[model samples]
Target: MRLLILGGTVFLGRAVARLARASGHHVTCAARGVSGEPVAGARFVQVDRDHPAGLSALDGERFDAVVDVTRRPSHARHAVAALADRVGHWSYVSTCSVYADNATPGQRADTAKLTVPAPVEVDNPVGEHADFYGPCKVSCEDAVRDGVGPERAFICRAGLIVGPEDPSDRFPYWVARLARGGEVLAPGTPDDRVQLVDVDDLAQWLLYAAENGLAGTFDGMSAALSRSRFLAEVAAGVGRPDPELTWVEQDFLLARDVRPWTGERSLPLWLPLPEYGGFLARDVTDSLAAGLRIRPIAQTAARTLEWIRASPGDVKAGGLEPAQEAEVLREWAARQ
Candidate 1:
């Protein structure tokens, strides 16, 4: 099958491109031309998605399907329209956050709350209207359903996506923190529900959806594990004792002032109010139906540690090895 994967330089997008190529599909990747060099067999097309050049450059190219991962609702509403009449099937990468009510635990994909309606005016930015980014993604899902009706559209709503090449440093922090003997901060209750899809599983299901001609919103969740058990594996991976971890109350965490995030809100770097509401609570039974599988938690931790050790020179470096992080923790103890 011929395929086009938008944005394959990092994270899930990169995994998709590699998997597609290995499966003997003709694959091409389009991006903003910032990161990642071209893959050996696949073609790399770089065009700013907003600029006329980005959309116009692909005027002549054709594919059976286009995986719209890089798109926000504003950009996707326009981009998918270009392919609505041409592409065989359109799969939009969406977040599970699109669910109207995420604070509640154990909501299935089929739940009424999961499907957010498209806004009356999609042209306006959606993020501004939604209380959190979840609603913003809801608007994006609406655009895709608009372009290609439910029968031909695939909404791959992912839970927390973590694995190799994790650029954001969100999950990696917990992994590395436990690896080095440090006082770990438990953001919320250890048993608080958390779900994540490994990058490999995400790519596999995405390609399967495009190939099978199947279309529906699939909640892609690979594993459901508590925070305490998750980090314990990381500690074991690096040959460390299950180091001490202080389970801080959620309200206490919110009360303590922390650094600002990006150009937006100011709160705990990890538990910002808007983000905390969504991530602090999530359940993804629907994603399991989509064939999302995870390596054992212990295995996931071991591999993450392995990747960190192998890629020490990487800019996103520092996951335990070198003894530096451990030394810092020791100094903090001395000061305490």
Candidate 2:
């Protein structure tokens, strides 16, 4: 199989290229070449997707499959316009954030209501316009499906993707914290739900869809797990199975100004309950049934820790510093 990845220098795209190469598929990665380097085995084509003619370098090229992981609607539209006719299968990596109702759990991709697509003027979503991220993806999904038609388009609505080479701090924070081994400050209740897909697992599924010509929309993540199990598996994976975890109430944490998800003074992957109950607890039964294989969290955690150790400077830093955690824990204990 001949595979072409549109943005192959970064996380998920790189994973897909690497896996495709290893699977004996001839892989070609087309990118701006500024983010990161593509895997050693795949062919690299330096092309800018920001302009309409940027992809003209590959004028007569064709591929068995093309995987595009672009947040910009313009990029998606340009790729589809340039290569939709020649590519055998088109896979667009989208996010679960496109769903309009995040408070309701167990919503399937086919039945869920999607947010409004970005307006025609908004090309890039950044900083103050961050909320446009999901909507832009919706526009991108629309372009792919409309360009290639549903029979040849695979739309993957991915959840929180975590594993080795992850550019986010959400999952890696737990791996590093657990490896430290001490009185760790855990957020929310132990029963709070969590969901994520390993990068390799997601990449494999994308390849499977391309190889088998699977079409239609589906969430891309593992089955949801309790927060306690999530942390325990991570700890065990990092060789700290018995760390002391102090589960703090959500109200207390929020009152103390501790942020949720990723960022400074934040507990990564810890979102406020009820409001975001469905965000991390998506029903991926259809995804699983459609060849999305999920490995154990322990395995994902251990591999992530190894990657962090090898590339310490590459991991993005945005979690509770030890002192902030200690201070929050101290406050919580006092309230208790």
Candidate 3:
């Protein structure tokens, strides 16, 4: 099979490209070539996808399948328009964030309402403006569907994708921090639910689905795990089981100005709001039925820790600093 992968130089895209090549598919990776080397065993083609003729390099080419890993709607729109005629199948790597409300549990792939007021143009959706990310993706999914027809497209509404070479560092932070063996600051309750898909698993599934002509939306995720169990698994993966976890109340953490998710002062994977109760517990029944498989959580954690150990420079980029966590812990202990 011949495959074309958009944005294959980093993370999930890189994984897909590598796996496709390993499966004996001839792979072409289209990107600007600025984000380091392309995956091994794949041909490289430079295309910005933001510019008018960015996809011109592959204008006359054809492929058995095209996997688009770009986040921008405009790029999806253009890529579909450019390759729709030549590609046999289209697989889009979308996000579960497209769901307008995860406040309700058991939200199915097709039943969940997508974010509205979709972005008309592309821009970096960050910080308080991150709401735009979902809407933009919603638009992208629609564009892909409209361009290639829904029957020819496979839309993967993915959850938090974590593993080795993860640029986000959300899961890696917990794996690396807990290995340090200390009174770690834990947010919310031990039973708080969390869900994430391993990058390799997701990459493999996307390729398999596309090659097999599977269509429609599927949540790319794993079974949920309680906070305590999740941490324990991470400890086991990192070979550190002695860390004294001090589970802190969510309200207290909020009052003390501890933020949720990523950043220097935030606790990754800790959402304290009532509206987010179902956020990490999305229903993946359809995904599982469609042959989506999740690798063991311990394996994901161990692989992530190994990557962080190898590339130690930026391990602390999106996590709490040691001193800040210590100060928060001290203050919380005093209140008790």
Candidate 4:
């Protein structure tokens, strides 16, 4: 199969290109060559998706499938306008953020209410307009579906994607913390839910969808698991099986100004209850049934640890430092 990936330099896109190449598929990655390098074997075509005629370099090219992971609605529209007619299958990597309701758990992609698409005039939503991220993705999804029609389009609403080459601190924080093997600060209740898909798993599913010509939108993530199990599996994966974890209550953590979900002084993957109960607890039954294979969290964690060790510079730095965590634990114990 001949596959073309738009914006294939970063995380998910790079994973897809690497997997596709290993699977003997002829892969072509078209990007501006700024973010990161494309997979070693896949052909690279430097093209700027920001310009109107940027993709003209691939003018007469064709492919069996094209996967695009552009957050900008304009990029999506430009790709559709330029190559929708020639590509046999179109896969748009969207996000679960498009769902209108984050408070309700177990919502499926087909039944979930989506946010309003970005206004036709809005193209690049970033910085001060970062809230438009989800809405812009909605617009991009609309562009792909409308451009290629449902039969030839695959819309993947991905959740928190984590694994090797992850550009976020969310999952890696736990791996690093657990590897240290001390009084680890586990945030929220042990029963609090969390959901994420390994990058390779998601990439494989995307390729599966493209090869099999699977259509329709579906959430791209593994089944949700309790936070306790999430941490234990990660700990075990990183060779710290029986971690002495101190489960911190949300109220206490919030009171101390400890943030949630990726940033300085935050417990990554730990979100406030009720308000974001559904964010990581999505129902991916349909996705699993449709060829989305999820490996064990232990495996994902171990591989992520290996990647972090091999390329420490690549991992984003967030989450609580040791002193901050010790202070928070001290305060919590004092309150108790």
Structure candidate 3, residue pairs in collision: none
Please, what is the whole-model Cα lDDT of each candidate in the order they appear? 0.66, 0.93, 0.86, 0.94
Clash totals in order = 1, 0, 0, 0
User: What does candidate 3's lDDT look like per residue over 1-336, in tens digits?
Assistant: 999998888889999988988889999999998986787789999888878568999978889999997777778888887889999999999998888887877788888887784656544456666768888888888889999998999999889989888888588889878878788999999888998899999998998898889999889998788889889888888888656899999998888788898877888988866888878998898888888988778888888888888888755477778888899899999999
Clashing pairs in 2: none
| Model 3 weakest lDDT span, ten residues long | 117-126
> Which lDDT value does model 4 have at 146?
89
lDDT tens digits by residue: candidate 4, 1-336? 999999788999999999999999999999999899998999999999889888999999999999999999989988999999889999999999999999999999999999999987777778877889999999999999989999999999998999999999999999999999989999989999999999999999999999999999999999999999999999999999989999989999999899999999999999999999999999999999999999999999999999999999999999999999999989888878
TM-score of each: 0.79, 0.99, 0.95, 0.99
Per-residue CA lDDT of model 2 for 248-313, tens digit only, reads 999999988999999898999999889999999988889999999999999999999999999999
**What's model 1's TM-score?**
0.79
Model 2: per-residue Cα lDDT at residue 21: 89
Residue 5 in candidate 4 has what lDDT? 97
What's the distance in Å from true for residue 315, model 3? 3.7
Alpha carbon lDDT at 240, candidate 1: 73
Per-residue C-alpha lDDT of model 1 across residues 202-272, encoded as one tens digit per residue: 88888888998878887777555676776676677667757787665556434443222211112112443
Q: Alpha carbon lDDT of residue 203, candidate 1?
A: 83
